[model samples]
Target: MTRILIVGGGYVGMNVALRLQRRLRHHAEITILDADSYMTYQPFLPEAAAGNLEPRHLVVPLRQVLHRCRMLNGWVVGVDSERRTVRFRPHQGEGYDLPYDLLVYAPGSVSRLLPVPGLAECGIGFKTVEEAIHLRNHVLAQLDLASSTRDEAIRRRALTFVFVGAGFAGVEALAELEDMAKDACRYFPAVDAADMRWILVEATGRILPEVGPEMGAWTLEQLRRRGIDVRLDTRVRSAENGRVVLDDGDEFDTDTLVWTAGVRPHPLVRATDLPRDDKDRVKVTPHLTVVGRPEVFAAGDSAAVPDLTRPGELCAPNAQHAVRQARTIADNIVARLRGRPLREYRHAYAGSVASLGLHKGVAQVYGVKLRGPLAWLTHRSYHLTRIPTVNRKVRVLVDWTLALFFPRDIVSLGALAEPRKEFEFAAGAPDGAKTGTQDGTETTVPRPAGARF
Candidate 1:
């Protein structure tokens, strides 16, 4: 049996595994290597952050979905395509080499962080389920702190939320969270909706470039109508010590800073002995095969796939392309194994849908525009079909159904991030002190000084 090694169990990786398992079955041995055991449906992240849907429901367990394929929880540190060996490093173990007859490189993209000051320390990225949940807890915690604090400066800072980047992630995340925060204020007597400051800073002149300028402008108008300070054609010069300094000579203190600035190809791509384009993405033909390497295939955000619909353009690194590319990848891989003619991936760009809080959204599909409740419903209905697994789909639908009756869950479980802190202090174990395990192994786990949120 042929050993097929797949890197990054994300949208492309997980889907490819699922398709291959059904197609190739016992004919080939498939192994997926990923940092996380679950695949996150990123479209639902904003809703998850807003407590509209449970974060746990947004992720599909790789092991559960890809039962036939072997699952390895690790990061691909390096890949030697010439040797057909991949170097993988687990969360708590040493590195190892894995040999494979065929390679599927779909490690996905990481947050494309700029060299802005204090960003690494202060800003949070909205990508994974963990980040989404953390952001929700953190945002709610900020509201809690602001309501309780008597200091005007601290209260002001805590209530002020600043989101950088006006892409789908940034805009939707801010919109949903803002709506949740505003609704949450009804319970806090000390805080009002007007007291809190919500600001959106975009480097580009437009927002939601996926939905076109008209919809983007309309979104801008809608956001501005909601009293959100939408600053266009501006950049974040610095975010030092919770103080945000913008290029347009404006500065403000904010306890919350979300950086959804966009993404770059995962560093693992650069570490591979693969043909990379100028953008550092694996150069691939329309068949999803890596350039000059028949045994190696790449797709999703990591592959610079040529756009057949448009001449001289690469497919945009988005979920729309990634999910469809997955189908072609699986088909091509099976064809390669069976000595059959492989099919080329050719799909025209489908328009985008963006939810702006409950009962409000904007969508552009096949040049047909939709807004308000219709668009919001479209956004939910579209993602509902895409998130994977009937179990997850039903659960998410139930969540939305429940939301129509009950209020949104605004409780902050920030302490969950540092569950051991209180216990360690109670046990009289000093911060960074070594603790003995059941097998008499000593490990030093550093106790957090306080809640970072």
Candidate 2:
């Protein structure tokens, strides 16, 4: 039996494994390696951050979804394409080499970071579920601190939120966070909506550059109407010590700084011996096969697939293109195994849609422009149909249904970070000294001279 190895189980890896299972009858053992056991639906991240959707519902468990395929939760550290061996670093143990007859390289992208000072310490990227959940919890905690503080400067800083970048991830995350934080103010008697400050600093001249200029202008107007400060043609120079310094000479103190600038392909591309483009993307033909290597296939954010329909253009790295490319790659791979001619992937660019907040959005679908509640409904409907798994769809639909009656789940369960915190507190450590829980999972953090948690 042939052994096929699929690396990085994101949208591409998951789709390839499932499609190959049905298409190929060559009796191959398919194994998938990924850092996380679940695949995250990134479009729902903003809603998850704003407490509109539960974070858990955004992830599809690989073991449950791909029960027939062997799923391994580990990191693919390096790939020796020439030797047909992949170096995998297991999550809980030593690293090992896995040899395969055919390799599907689909590891995706990572947060594209810049060399701005203090960014590593202060900035949070809006890329993962952990970051989204932390943003929600940290924002709610900030409100709690602001309401409890008597000092004006500290209160002002705590209530201030700054987001750098104006693309979909940045804009959607900022808008959703601002909406949720403002709505959460109702619960804090001491906190007023007026005290909150939401600022969006865009390096470009306009936000949502994917949408046309007119739509971008309209989005700017809508954000301005919501009292959000939109700084255009601006750059965030430094975020040192909670102080945001901009190129326009404007500076402000903000507790939260979200950096959603963009993403670059994952480093695994360079780790392999396969040929890559100047942009560090795996160079693949129009059929999703790595150039000059028939046994190796690539797709999704990590692969630079030439746009056959449009000259001098590469496929944009987005969910729309990623899913289609994954499906095409799977089909082409099966064709290669069965000695059939490969099919070329040629897709036309579709319009984009984005949500501002609840009951508000902008959409340009098939040359038709829409805004307000209708656009918002369209945005939800489109993503609802695209997100994988009927189990997740039903769970998310239930979450949406529950939201119509009860209020949003704004309460921040900060203790979720340290699940054993309450257990530690209840263990009765005399004089707050070091002590262990009954389960032996507690770690004692000695209190500094006058420090507070």
Candidate 3:
């Protein structure tokens, strides 16, 4: 029996695995090994962070969808291309090897981080469900802290939020979360909406570069109208000591720093013996097969598959290409298994859509530029059609419907992210002795002046 092993259960891995299960007709023994057991629908992450969508609904269980294929919850550490084996560490045990007659390498990208000061300790990426939840909790907690504080400076710092990138993730996240925070203001009498500040700092001259210059300008105008401070052609030099310094020489103290700069292919891709492109993506043929390796194939963000539609350009790392490429890859695998001819992958760039809060959005679909409520509606409709599974589609739609009638849920569950922090601090404190000046006042750790309330 032919054995097929797929490494990574992301958009590409899950989609290809499903397509293979359908086309292979039980002739192949397919197994998918992923670091996480769930497949995250990444596009919904911004909404998840804003509480517009539930974190649970943002991911689909692999076991539920890939019913026919064996799902191994583990990390793929190494690939021995010479022996046609992959080295993986399971969740509960030591590393093991899995041999495959044919392999599909689709380990997706990770947050592309830079060596900026204080970023590692202070910043949060908006990639996974965990990160989204953390961001939502942190944002809400900031508001809570600010409302409870009497210190004007501390309140000001706590209410200030900064986003480093202006790409799809950063822009959408800022818009949605700002909208949520604005609606949540009704619960806090002390904290006014005008007191809160949302800042977007982009090194590039434009945001949503994927949507063309006109739409990008329109988005900037919309955000500005909402009082969002967008700093284009500006770079963040450092964010150390709770002080954010920009290239333009502006400095401010802020607590929330969101890093959605960009993404890079998984580091495991570098371990593979296969040829790679300049961007560290595996170099693949037009048919999505790795160069000089007939048995191994790759696609999606991790693979640099030649874009036949544009002779000089490689396919952009987006769901539009990932989904289309997965189909072609599955078909090619099926053809190879059955001794038939394989087809090449080719697709033109469809326009993009961006949601700028509730009834405001920008879209350039099929060369038609739309803005305001119509664009927002189109954005929702497009994603609703693309999100996998009837169960997910219905649930997401229900969430949207509820959002119309009910106020946004701005409750902070920040402790959930670091549940044991307080316990650890308590455990380390001096033996039941209140360490403070003797004035019958309980000793409290003095937070940094710039730290959030």
Candidate 4:
């Protein structure tokens, strides 16, 4: 039996593993090695951050979905194509080398962070489920801080939110979060929606470039109408101590700084000897097979698969292409094993869809444009159909239905971050006096000046 080892449990790796496991059952030995046991449905991340959907529902368990395939939880440190061995380091214990006959190297992308001062210490990325939920809790916690604080400077800083990047992730996250925060203001008597400063700083000329320029302009207009400061052709120079200074000479203090600039291929790609493009993405042919390495397959954000639809261009690193490319890669892998001709991976650019908030969005599908509530419905309906597993679909639908009848849950479970605090206090400091300060006053921990989660 052939040994098929998949390096990542992301969109491409998971889908490819799922397909190959079913198609080559009892014929081939399949395995998946990933840092996490779950695959995040990234499209729903913004909603998850906005409290429109539960964070748990945005992720699918790899073990549950890929039961037939061996699940190995570890980080892919390096890949040796010549030796056909992958170096992996698990959560604990020593690192090991796993050999394979066929390699599916699709170790997706990571946040593309620049060397901006204080960014590493202050900024947060909006890629994973943890970040999404944490951001939600953090945003609400800021509202709490703003409403309770009497200091004008602290109140202003707490109420100010800044986001860099105008892509789908940045735009949708900012929009959904702003909407949730505005709605949540009603509950906080001291904080009003107008008091909150929602700033979107994009280095580019426009936002939502995935959708056509017209739709992008429309979305920009909609955002501005909501009092969102859409700063175009502006970049962040520094975010030192939560004091944001823009390239356009504007400076402001904000507690929340979200960096959704974009993502680059996983570092593992460069760690390998595999042929890569200038972008560090593994170079693949139309068949989704690595260049001159027929036994090796690649897809998703990590693979620089040639876009047959547009000559001289590579497929855009998005879910629309990733999911489709997985099918082709899987079929070709099976075909190679069965001594059949491989199929070329070809897909036309299916339009784009984006949600500004609940009942607000923009979409352009196959030359047809849509906006407002209709586009929002279209966005939800499309993603609902695409999100893997019937179980997750039902849960997401139920959440949306509940939203129609009830208000969005604005409660911040900030304590989730420090769940062990109380337990540690109880265990280590049994006596109340021991937990107090030298003056016998209860030690009051200072609240974090910025987002903690």
Candidate 5:
């Protein structure tokens, strides 16, 4: 049997593997290797972070989905394509090399970080589930601190939130969190929505570049109208020492610094001996085949797949392209198995959709522009159709339906970060067993610096 090895569990790899399993069953053995057991539906990450949807619903377990295929929870360290061998380290296992007949490399991107001083130590990226959860917890905790604090400096710093990106991820993240914070403020007697400072610093001239320039301008206006400090043509000089200093010489003290700048191809790509583009993405032909290597295939954020629809343009690293490419590749793989000719990939540009918070959005679909609540509905409806899995789809839809009746859930379960804190404290209870932190261990989500009672 031909042993086919697939890497990465993102939209491209997982989608392709699942489809290929049904088509090429009894002909080939499909094995998938990924660092995470679950594939995150990144489109729903903003809603997940905003507490609009449960985090569990946004991720599909690879084992459950890829039932027929063998699953390996591991990291692909390097790929020796010439030798047809994969060197990887499985979770809690010794590093080993696995030989394969065909390879599907779909390793996705990582946070594109710059060499900014103190950024590595202080800044947080809004990419993964963990980061989203941490951000939600941290934001709420900051609110708690601001509300309970008597110190003016601490209160000011606690309320100031800064995000350094204006792309889809950054905008949605900031918007959703802002909406949640605004709603959550009602519960805090001392906290007002106005007290919170939301600063969106973009080095570029505008936000939401994926959307047209007109829509982008409208987004900027909407943001400013909603009281967000939209700093355009401004770059971050330093975020060192809780000081958010910009290129324009403006500085502010903020406790929260979110770095959603962008993402680059996976670091593992660099470690492998593959011909890469100037952007470090694997150079793949229009068929999503790595140059000079017919057996090896790649797609998604890791590969620079030529866009046949737009001359001289590479396919954008988006969910739409990733899913479509995976399906095309899967079909082509079956064709190859049957000694049929391969097909070229091509797709016209689809419009973009963005949610600007609860009941607010902007979208341009098939040349039809929509704004406000209508656009928001389209955004939700479009994504609901594409988020994958009947179970997840039902769950997500239910969440949205429930939101109409009940207000947004803004209560932060900050203890989720330090689950053992209470247990650890119980083990070291004092003579009187006071309900207070005995240890000086600072948690990732620090509470208000005042009396609880």
Candidate 6:
């Protein structure tokens, strides 16, 4: 029996896996190994952060969806293409190896980080569901801390939020969170909406650069009208010790810093001996087959597939392209198995949609520009249709319905991410501290006088 192994479970991975199962029957054994057990619909992350959608509903469980395929929840630590074997470390089990007749490499992208000072420790990237939830909690927690503090400077610092990217992720995250914070002000009398500041810093001259210049300018105008500080052609010099110093000479103290600047292919792609492009993405032919390796295929953000439609351009790393490319990849795989001609992957670029908030957004679809409620509706409709599972789609709709009848839940659950930190700090010990139990009495360990928590 032929064995097929797929890495990563994002849009491309899941889509291709489903397509293969539907096309290949039981002749091939399909196995998908992802670092996370659930597939996150990344487009809904901004809304998840704003409490407009439940975080749990944003993820589709692989076990439930891919029932026919063997699902291993683990990280692919190494891939030996010559041996036709892939090694992975399961979430709670020992390392194992799986031999594959054909391999599909789709380990999606990671946060593209720069060498900015203090960014590693203080910055949050808007990619994973964990990051989105952490950001939502952190922002609401800052409001809580601000309301409880009597120091004006401390309150102001807590209320200031800085986003380093003006692209779709950064802009939508900022807009939704800002709207949530403003609505949350009704409950906290001490913290006024005017007291909060939301700033977006982009290195380029305009944001949403994927969209045309006119729509980008219109987005800028809308954001500015909402009192958001949109700084263009600006860069961050440093953000050390809660002090954000911009290249444009503006300096401020802000506790919240989000870095959605960009994304690069996962580092695991480099481990393979396959050919790669200048950006470190695996180089693949128009048929989405890795160069010089007919048994290996790659797609989504990790593969640099040739865009035959444009002749010189590479496929963009967006859901629209990824979803479409998955179909071609599945078809090509079946073709190769059956000794038939494979089809090349090609698709024209569709327009973009960006949600500013609940009733505010900008969209450019098929050369038509739209803004305000129309754009917002388009944004919702497009994502609604794109989300993988019908169960998740209905749950997300219910979440939206609940939001209409009730105020957004602004309570922060920061401790959920690090629940033991507070206990360790109070016990005067570091993480992995020793605790003694005698007759149900808990004894805490004491730390050295100069030791930090």
Best-performing candidate as measured by TM-score: 4
User: Could you tally the backbone clashes for each prediction?
Assistant: 0, 0, 0, 0, 0, 0
Candidate 3 deviant stretches above 4 angstroms: 420-453
lDDT of 5: 0.87
lDDT of each: 0.92, 0.88, 0.88, 0.92, 0.87, 0.90
Candidate 3, run of 10 with poorest lDDT: 444-453
lDDT of 2 by residue, 290-397 (tens): 998878889888999999879889998988888898899888877777888999999987889998988889988888889999989999999999889899999899
- lDDT of each residue in 1-453, candidate 1, tens digit only: 999999989889999999999999899999999988999999999999999998889999999989999999878899898899999998897999999999999999999999999999999999888898999999899888988989999999999999999999999999999999999999999999999899999998999999999999999999999999999999999999989999999999998999999899998888888999887899999899999998998999989999999989999999999989999999988888878999989999889999999999999999999999999999999999998999999999999999999999888999898888876665676444667889989887565535332
**lDDT by residue for model 5 over 290-376, one digit each (tens)?**
898888888999999999988999999988999999998888777777889878889887988998888889899888888899999
Tens digit of per-residue lDDT, candidate 4, span 165-239? 999999999999999999999999999899999999998999999998999999999999999999999989999
In model 5, which runs have C-alpha deviations exceeding 4 angstroms? 428-453
Cα deviation at 239, candidate 6, in Å, is 1.1
Report RMSD (Å) for each prediction in the order shown: 5.5, 4.6, 3.3, 2.5, 3.5, 4.9
Query: Lowest-scoring 10 consecutive residues by lDDT in candidate 5?
Result: 444-453
Q: Candidate 4's C-alpha lDDT? A: 0.92
Expressed as tens digits, the lDDT of each residue in 53-146 for candidate 6 is 9999999998898888999887888888889999888878799888999999999999899899988888889999999999999999888889
TM-score of every prediction relative to native? 0.94, 0.93, 0.93, 0.96, 0.94, 0.93
lDDT of 5 at 69: 92
Instruction: Output the TM-score of candidate 4.
Output: 0.96
| lDDT score of residue 449 within candidate 2 | 25
Error of 6 at 190 (Å): 0.7
